[model samples]
Target: MKILWIDDEIDLLKPFIYLLQQEGYEVETATSGEDGVELARREVFDLIFLDEIMPGVDGLEVLRKIKNENSQQIVVMVTKSEEEDLMKKAYGSWVDDYITKPFSFNQLLSVLNRTLKRRSIISEQMAEEYATQFRTFSEPADYLEWVDYYKSIVSWDLRLLDYGSNDLKVLQKEKKHEANAGFAKYIENNYRDFLNGKGPTLSNNLFAYAVLPVLKEGPVHFVLFDSMRLDQYYKLSNSLREFFEINTEFYYSILPTATPYSRNSLFSGLLPLEILQKFPQYWSFEEKGQNRFEKELFAELLKKHNLRIKYSYYKLSSIQDIERSINSIVNDKADIVITVINFFDLLLHSIPGRGDMKGVLDDERVLLNLLGYWFPLSPIFEIFKRLSKKQRRIILTTDHGFIRVRKPTIIYGGRSISPNLRYKYGPALRVDNKTALLLNNPGDISLPYEDPSVRFAIAKEDYYFIYPTKPTEYEKEFKFTFQHGGISMEEMILPYAIMNPR
Candidate 1:
């Protein structure tokens, strides 16, 4: 590594420089701030060590000039002074790190190793760890084990994202596919039982089980961001830690992992067929605006629990809506506030190759990188920030997650079939039994339909359903785009978090 050290007493640091050079570093010395600034401008460096106190054009000023020129430069401030104000000033000016004078050679070496070799070291360690774990891999036996297993995969995926080899990523992908197949089988076997009251927490009873107990604590603000995956939630959780203490758990989404099904079940505390039977006015066959009666359903849910309290509900479709209504959402004095943010759902279903999304939407990692870049500036982040200050108890979750479909499964269905790419429902639907779950009766799985003959075909793994006619055309439009309404680990297992202001 190439390093530049700036100190007024350059002769005094000769011993330190010799030690660094002996450790395979190329070192250059500057005796004054003027010379240091000039050298920094003319030459590129892996790291620059600047003295915090100097006689002429002190270290802080030189640090500012260097940062102004190239903000990405790594500069470590070294000083004999122990004042907090000076250290803060150096850091405020964007110093990469700080060190006090009379430090040992090992301390200097430790800093250099951290600044230059951290990524590579971490990457190597993670690769070894994963390789070790790969030998002992086994299929999860149940949903609870599956939750832990899926979480492990997601954790590795995120870490490998920043520091993993291509081979490791491919291996992880294969393992995820295997897990999805197992999860699909598990669901096929136990889903009906789950709905029959043998499964863990699900969408229909989430509000009753998770939210109602928290209600007695204090006022609650429940925010549901549509189509949020576990990986995306991990990214958001890192940012939320600054203002709140977050406790997150996993929950299962009901069959047909789509908004009209899962989200409606979430609010109404009833399965799709139950909703149709009990509240026909709120249930509909149409996909669009199916969630329009969420408030009414929520009211009904409240009544069922025998709890009557004022609650405000808001469904925001865009950033503009969040910007315009966030104040009201934060200021409302209701016993509970529910806000459904639709940006992530819209992001998943929107067409690709649009504006900045020219090449991002097709790749999950790139899409997540885009989200990481946008989250801090997003109005949704602003809502969280504002809500954190109010000390309100907050519950956060999503209707369902999505998976990027890579394989296409051909199926035959009438024109009345639902338009979702991951699943199809209508009369006499025909799909390969190996690639999907062909439910002969929709009502058997608690899906809603007036006719008893209507059936459902839900795709498994990374498959998307395409019609027999013009299959290529359909594949071209849907391939690699994220989709829901199917049985996959990403779709069924979801993140449920409770945040309290710190």
Candidate 2:
């Protein structure tokens, strides 16, 4: 790739240029910012390394000019001043990276290489690496250990995604789809055992294992944001690392990874049916009103566990609520604080409602882009930092993750059937028997029974449920909308992280 280096001390940087050239990079030099801008305009260099201090048209001015000309150009600020205020000013001008003066040639080369080679290196290297191991672990018969393999593949996929390598991303996606197909077969065979408590930790066992121990340590703050996919979790988890050492673990969300059930089960520490039976008052199957509180099941869980500490539960549905929650936490010292932010979940559901969002988050890559823009600046993160300052232990997790629905499956159900693209809850619902995890007895899975004949069915993989009455219409409407409550790694695998103030 071509790199343009602009510096008044360009002659002194001969060693750096030679090292980069030896590394196979096209090194172009300009003695002044004006010359650098001319070269940039004349040629399409991949990146520009501009010195902050220059005789005429200083780095900041040059940066402003470059951005005005082509905002997409990648520019790194090289500065002799290590002053915090100057660094901040350079960053504020939108430079990709800042390099201090007197830096080693190796460090300079490393930064340049990372910036230019991130995509190519990750794409080619990761694809080749995963391809070899893919064969060794592709067997469907080895279901017992598939979870780890699946997680490994997902971890790589997320890594490549972060690396922003489109080619490797596509390759990893295809591989992951292949793994998911095999995983579907495995789940079909073993799901019954898992739900029946004859196997590993499924949805029912997630909270008991993940949350209870943390609670015992001190106070446990569980933030169960809905529809937080694993990749998004990876992005947000990076921020938490500053204050919390993450002991990351995953659990399989029950078939329907949707909020009403999956999130309820997570907070209540009981399956859907058990929640209804245990807390009928809080459990509402009503079509209208905030079905979220379904019951004050969370409060009951703490009570049942005999874990008594001052705790607060806040649901942030609006920007105002988020600000308020952050403001409140800044002053108070609650033992535990559980805040559920619905922005991601709302974003998913709203994708179908709003044409713009649907167009933006059309795929996983786009979805991650959207997430990267929002999560770090999110009110939850702001509150987290404030809480960290108070030296409080924190646990940030999600109810379930989301998947971009591609294939649509038509199902015939009565008018009484609940209309959810990822899952269906009604009697006389007709679906492909093999494609869904059908819960004939909701009671067994601890899900509430809406009717005496009510049953729950969740779509698997990238599939979403559509009614036969308006098959084509619904298919067109919900094709690319993000939905949950199905069986896929994105939906089922949940993230649990514990953090203590650094």
Candidate 3:
């Protein structure tokens, strides 16, 4: 490992340098910040040790310049003074490690071992450990243990953060798919029982079970991002730590992880059959701009419970809309706010299948990185950032998650059917053993249908339903794009998180 030590008192660090060299590290020493900057620009360094008190150029300025050159350069600040402001500045500049003046030589060695081995020498052991643990992840005792399976997958994903796209991580993705196959079967068997409160939380009961009762305590801000996966939430959770203490849990999405079902169920606190029976005018099949009655559904739920409070609901589609409405709506006196942000779902649909998306959003990790980057820069992020100052209780979650569809399965259906690519519903739907579930009658699973002959078929694993008429054309369009409304871990398992002000 190549390490650079920049200190005005270069003679004082000779013992530390000798120890590091004996430990098989190449050490380069600089007597001044100017010399250090020149050396850093000239050569690559695995790590940099910076002195807080310097003569000509101070430590903060050197830290700024080094970060300006390479933002990801690992820096450690060694300081004698215990000024809170100075330590904060060092930390804000992305210092990887910090040490006090009187810290033991062994302490410095411990820091070095932790920081350096994360990049090298630990991959073999981590891979072997994951290989053994993969067997445990593959088996689940029941439907509840499926949540544990999802947690295990998230654990593996977290461990692979510093090391992206390694072979072990790749194998973990396959194992995740394997685990999802098991979860799909589990949901097929006991989804209805769970909906009746048998096991893990489901999408239909989120409002009644999780949100409304919590609202009895204080005002809450609920933000829903459509079509965001559980793994994607983990990617974005690290960023939330700066503003709030996040508490996350897993829940299963209702079948047909699509918006009209899962999102509507969330707002109404009832299944589709119940919604159709209660408010017949609310149900509409508008695909692109569906769930138009969510505001009404929220109102109905509040009124059903005979509770009254100030609240606001928004379904924001554009960044401009978010910017325009956020200021006015947040300023209003309200006990609760529900905002449905549509950027993540839209990006998934519009990006993939375009010829230029080969390197941009070709897989799960790349697409997730793109989406996670957008979350912090989003106007909603800025709004929540302002809310954080007020110590508002913010609930961050999604209506449903999405799965990347790989294999194409043929489905023979009627002239007009449900437009979801992952599943199809119509009268006399002809589909066989490749189904996640075959609902012979829609009412049995709480699905709404005017005709009793109408049945539903959801795709299993990574399959997307392709029509017999245009097999090749449909394959060209949506062979590997992210989709929901089906059965899979990424689609059904959800991240339900709450952020309390820190």
Candidate 4:
């Protein structure tokens, strides 16, 4: 790593610099703080050693300038002074570490080891831990163990993304896929029973399990960003950390993991079949513009819970709709505000169909950059910024997440089959059984279907179903684009967070 040291007593520090260089650090020296400040601005250094009480520009001032250039840059204050005021000033300037003068090589080495090399050390340890623990989660875990396994992998993925090497990241990703493969099997075995309240909190149980408890604290703004995955939430959480203390967990979206099913289940607090039976007016399964009935369903949920609460529900799709909604939000007030933002979901669909944005659909880094660019323009971001100032409890979640489809499983189905890339249903549906779940009866899993002859084929892992009629066209369109509505960990698992003002 690159190192820069600034001190007026350069002669005395020659031994230390020579030692660092011998130990494989590229060390540079500046005799004055002014020179050091300019050098830091001109070049990139992994670590900086700034002398306190230096001539011209002073150490504290130089430290401030360096921090202004790059807040995350690691800078250690090396000084003879133990004075409280000077040390406080150094700390205030974002000094990453400290070392006193009249110290030996061991002391300096200790500081360097802890401060400069910390990320690499931590990354190595974490990668080793994951390697060691891989086998425990490699086998099929039961429901609770599966969640715990997913949690471990998610945590490791987030950390490894920050510090691990490319090779380690690949290993972690492979382990993740292994876990997902096992999870798909687990879901196929129990998903039908799970929809009947056999397991933990589900999409249908969200309002009762998550919403009411959050509402008891204060006013709430619930944002459901459709097709948002866990990796996406890491960036979002960082952006929001400055405004809110975040509490995070997740719930499993019922299959098929699509907006029409999972989102409806979330708002209605009932499975699709139950929603249809209990409130026919609010049930508009897979119909165009069906999300328009969400407010009515939400109202029905409040009444069913005997909640005497006021709420404002909005399903924002167009820019004009968002403008109006923002205006209404700024002017009016409600106890609960629910907004379903669909840009990510739209992005996922548009990518495979439209070539302009296709390059980002399969690359995680590019996709994250696109998201970073889009967040500033997003109405949900504005809502978060506005609500941060108010005493509001904010919730950011999604109906379902998505996965990039790599393997295309060929199938044959009638024209009545659902057009979702990850799933299809019809009497003629046929495919290799091991690639996905082929349900002969929709009602067996509590899913809604009009015809008795219709069956379901939901893709698992990275597979997407393709019809034999349009092989070339389907292959060209959706080879690596993100899609949901299947039983992979990405689609089934979702992020649920409660944000309190910081």
Ranking by TM-score: 1, 3, 4, 2
**Between prediction 2 and prediction 4, which has the larger TM-score?**
4
User: Which runs of model 4 end up more than 4 angstroms from their true locations?
Assistant: 1-123, 135-140, 285-287, 318-320, 345-356, 373-379, 470-473
Please give the distance, in angstroms, between residue 302's alpha carbon in candidate 1 and its true position after superposition.
0.6
Pick the lDDT winner: 1
The residue-level lDDT of candidate 2 at 420 comes to: 79
Q: Taking the tens digit of each residue's C-alpha lDDT, what string does model 3 give over 126-212?
A: 777877876554478776677777877876776675343478777877887787777778778887787677877777778767787
Residue 209, candidate 3: Cα error in Å is 1.7
Q: Evaluate residue 215 in candidate 4 and report its C-alpha lDDT on the 0 to 100 scale.
A: 91
Counted clashes in each candidate structure: 0, 14, 0, 0
Better of 2 and 3 by TM-score: 3
- For every model shown, what is its TM-score relative to the native structure? 0.80, 0.75, 0.79, 0.76
Give lDDT tens digits, candidate 2, residues 1-502.
8889999899999988898889888989999887887676545677899999899788998886665444446788998788989878887877877788889987897777676665465457766776687666646464346657766876786666434356766777787777766777777777767777766666556667876777677765667676677767776675466566777776777766777777777777777777777777767787555246723776787788786777777777876777766777565556667777786855444343566665566656556545544554567668877778877777777777877788888777677888778888898777886667777787765667767788778788888888777789989988877787788777776666777778
Which one wins on TM-score?
1
lDDT of each: 0.85, 0.72, 0.78, 0.79
Say what the RMSD of model 4 is. 7.1
Worst 10 residues of 3 by lDDT: 345-354
Across 170-211, the per-residue lDDT of candidate 4 in tens digits comes to 888788777778888889888867777787689999889888
lDDT of 2: 0.72
Off by over 4 Å in 1: 1-115, 345-353
